[model samples]
Target: MLDAAEQYSREAFPSAKEFLRRLYDFEIYHRKTAPWNPVCVTGLPGGGKTSIFVAATRLLEDDTVNAGAGHVLPLLGFRHLTIEDERSELGILRRTCWAFNRQWSGTTSSAHEKTRLKEDDGFPMRDLKRARDTTALVGFRSGCCGVMVDEMQYMTQSTTANTLVTKSLLELSYLRFPFFFAANFNLVAKLLARPPQDRDRLLSNPVVVLPDTVATEISETAWKNYIRECKRVAGGVLDFDVDKDAESLVRYTFGLRRKFVIIIKSAYGRAREAGRFAAGMSDIEEAYKSTAYYTHRKDVESLIAMETSGKKEQKEFVCPIEVDSTEAMARHRMAQEEQGRAVAEQMVIDSLSPAGRLAYQQAGGPKPDAGEKSKGSGRVKTPVSSSSLLAGSDQFHRKRK
Candidate 1:
């Protein structure tokens, strides 16, 4: 069975879960047709690209009950798994060795020291090639059907590293081991500018772009459910007003699951510190202020505006208990009269067309007769020609002349 963390990550984001399903479907389809086709998944930071890969791979790993036809081999590697110094081809080769060896934790023993490649040992190009050969041997023996490289953006930073990584991936592709690369979408130019051979190898790879945030309804439901789950799991260690707190979280975090989790945890900590059982709106505000509110200021402001507008509408419609029935009925009648009057005014304005409405508003309602004078200024406002208004009037003379 998958661990709790992996299960939660997979279930929390429906998009990621769907992506995993599609990837699996593609894998099965490609294995029958073109077995060498790789897969690439791209997204922004904290968009759950890595989560999809982790969840998918863990599912494949933990599924011992359904020992399907052939072994479903999947391996996830990080930047550090390839080697620390990725400035050259040697570093790339070393990384391949490390990944294929599956001893990434680097627990060395004296007995195995002679056979293993030492970091400090001065090895020539031939020796490095030998290590790579050993990697291939071990990888083939281990039945590496698929290889996933997470944080692949780092590998494309330098021309040399990019070329070497591309070459390595292409070689692996030819060996029938489909590779999955996860990186930022900004690296599209670099990823496309590879050599012709690399392009040919990777061109067939399907790219999956992850959304940065969950859907509004999905997030709201998930967060409320999460609160209920927490209450049950934590055994009242943490408390929350599900509807109120979840709404605040969904709005403030703008549906970003990562930020939502961080802020809620921070708010929970604040509530605990204040000796309160429940994390409320106040704690949420405090948590948001301390976290990514400044970084995502515009989104936060928009969320605030939405909440404020909603509250304003709520207040406007709310009935007051202090008003007697007679006064309430009068107020309701007045409100209905005002609304009908405004609607009629708008209808009349709309019938006049754009030019007429402009003149009416500018002249402060309907125009007066030629002989009529203004109520306050005591002067008849005569209509002026467009050309005369553009040239010079006494009104313009004060400003221009």
Candidate 2:
């Protein structure tokens, strides 16, 4: 599955192939150098940034983990390094200790000690703290060479001048270990690209940008190929006729590869429910409606409106699916009403005691007796349920019967 996903990504994303090549190059560089300048990979959210790093790591680690048969690049560890890992200096220390152990467990005495201290409840807490605090990461530098930090945007630090994460980054930078920082946007800038002399000098190294925007012609073709491959592999699990409304498929998705696949998956499920051997354009359209919450409906509607408005343009345009203004208004109203009803229901539930709520039924929820009035309102309260309101017809039917 990983191999297929990696291949699919390489084709679907224009930058993916180049990114993988660079990642491998970084591993090679890290192997030659003990610690090196950190590399930053930035892109839009859900833009295949995480996928690239993960896929690259799999390729590098497979040789080492399996039979040690593949290229031995000493140690390149894969971890979901987040800003949360180093909220405090000690936190960073603990994370670094564990990260090193993950890469080189058997070789280093420091790794064994750290592992033992982590698992040992009986061990002196003070001693453990001292050991982690005083011992430098440089000691274990030879064992583990590279580290991948994902979601660098979430990294937080104390308001103090010398932040723990900053200090940790500095420490890692000095070691010359290549740090791969992957984030949705310029989050690494916060960690590495600071002002003046404070700015991380190591960050001046290299940057890998992942493809995140709307699908280009190449991207659209790649996505279509991906769909065909998926259908072939699934063996009738999904019957998506990519050729039927390929334009519709790409347009509705707004060119985000991740969103495209999600829509396809949802549409395929709808097809399965209808007992159809293959999903038609209708199924795809209906599936789109069901998962419409993910999209910026207003933006999509505007884009469709603009294209169909018969305005002056150099190119002829066609929309994948028609936006029904009337239906959209009705859906919007319905959604609003649903939300309002939910809020009102929650308010009523909040007003009721646990026992009172438990006693309340779908049939005209429990009403206060004449003797008992609302504490503040001094009025007899009647809590009605929608089910009870609809039950009036049933009563009439029973009487007529």
Candidate 3:
């Protein structure tokens, strides 16, 4: 039987495994058949969207894994293209063609053989736009398995780039090529903003990998389990109390698995620098406050604000899927307001003298409950409506005046 930590780690990314399974089934169905709808895996920057496709590619490439499936890869092969700085439509095409060619021709061959193969394929790399559709049709006829385009968010950097990327996607869809593309929400939003036909063709099939949220009991449990798993993986170099520090860690990292790992690693490094044997909660806090984590800290704060306020701003933190409806946004805003009131109430309570506190308690003034403690600060808090607080403040100011 698997240990609790090992089991949690294994089950941490069910979406990834499901993505791979879908790829496998797609290949099985389309190996000797026509192409089907392509899959688009989307998530936050560090949510492991790319890692899912990469793992799928590895499985597909492994002969042992493919032995049961007749070992015959489908057409288009397993081509992986990373869109870094490819700004134009032609650049995307060229990159796609290159990915196809590279996969078709094994990388182990001699340089001369590689050049000859490229020549034989007649892929007009220098002038693909001029050659147009004929070049892709001819070169890709021999067949590969699938294509995966990663870092598609780069295409949204400029208007020209965005238009060109959409054009390339439309072109691929028209060709009915089987492929997968991993992108962040910006690219997904851009595609969804396109015309009906364009949006339908490209984003009809989406695989969204979202981070674990701490809003619900089930998700919070999952987050805590994930933290424990990470701690177990750290072995002897880290010795933080998972039960005690998990909540703070979740708050610090905004429940992002990657950020959690980064914080843990940084904590370990800090411990070593301070001549400590193992990193603990103090090191984790120092790491989070360190210059190295400043950008991530800002990102976490931005994400928290966006979620709680239901206001979308283009910030460095771009993950937690869009809050769609007005009702949902209002709900989030209300929750935030309630929390703010709680904090304000706690501040007032903290300012009271001992005699004032006793008198207030005796006089039935509300006290903060244990559950009202802020997650980040651990200070007692109590809820009050924004309007009530504003009215109270106005009354106090009027009396002073």
Give the clashing residue pairs of candidate 2, or none: 35-176, 35-177, 36-176, 36-177, 83-155
**Top TM-score: which candidate number?**
3
Rank order by TM-score, top first?
A: 3, 1, 2
Worst 10 residues of 2 by lDDT: 312-321
lDDT of 1 by residue, 26-133 (tens): 434234433255566654455566666655554443211112345343332221122233445555555554555553322122334324555535334556545444
Give lDDT tens digits, candidate 2, residues 1-401. 23433432343223534433434454443344443456656544555666666665555441232213242333333433444433544545455555554543322224455456468443223454454423223222223335566654555433552344456556555444445666443344454445554454545544444222112445446667766776787677665466665655545554345665676677777887877766656666666666452453333444344434434232112222233455435434443454477569868866877567656633444344335445455666667889877797799999999
**Residues 1-401 of candidate 3: C-alpha lDDT, one tens digit per residue:** 01322332243213444434534454342344333356778877777776566665554342212222354333332556676666655656655655554534222224553355346555555664443454344323324445667766766777576678777776554333566778777777777778987777777778767666555556568877888877777777878777676666766787788888898889999899989879987677778887888888888777767777657786344543444355344445544864698689778877887677668766755544424553345655768899989999999999999
Candidate 2: Cα lDDT at 198 = 40
What TM-score does candidate 1 reach? 0.49
Residue runs of model 3 more than 4 Å from their true location after superposition: 1-36, 64-78, 101-121, 126-143, 217-229, 315-401
RMSD after Cα superposition, model 2: 17.1
Write down the TM-score of every candidate. Answer: 0.49, 0.49, 0.61
Better of 2 and 3 by TM-score: 3
- Report the number of backbone clashes for model 3: 5
Task: Give the per-residue Cα lDDT of candidate 3 at 137.
Answer: 46
Global lDDT of each candidate: 0.50, 0.48, 0.62
**RMSD, candidate 1, Å:** 18.2
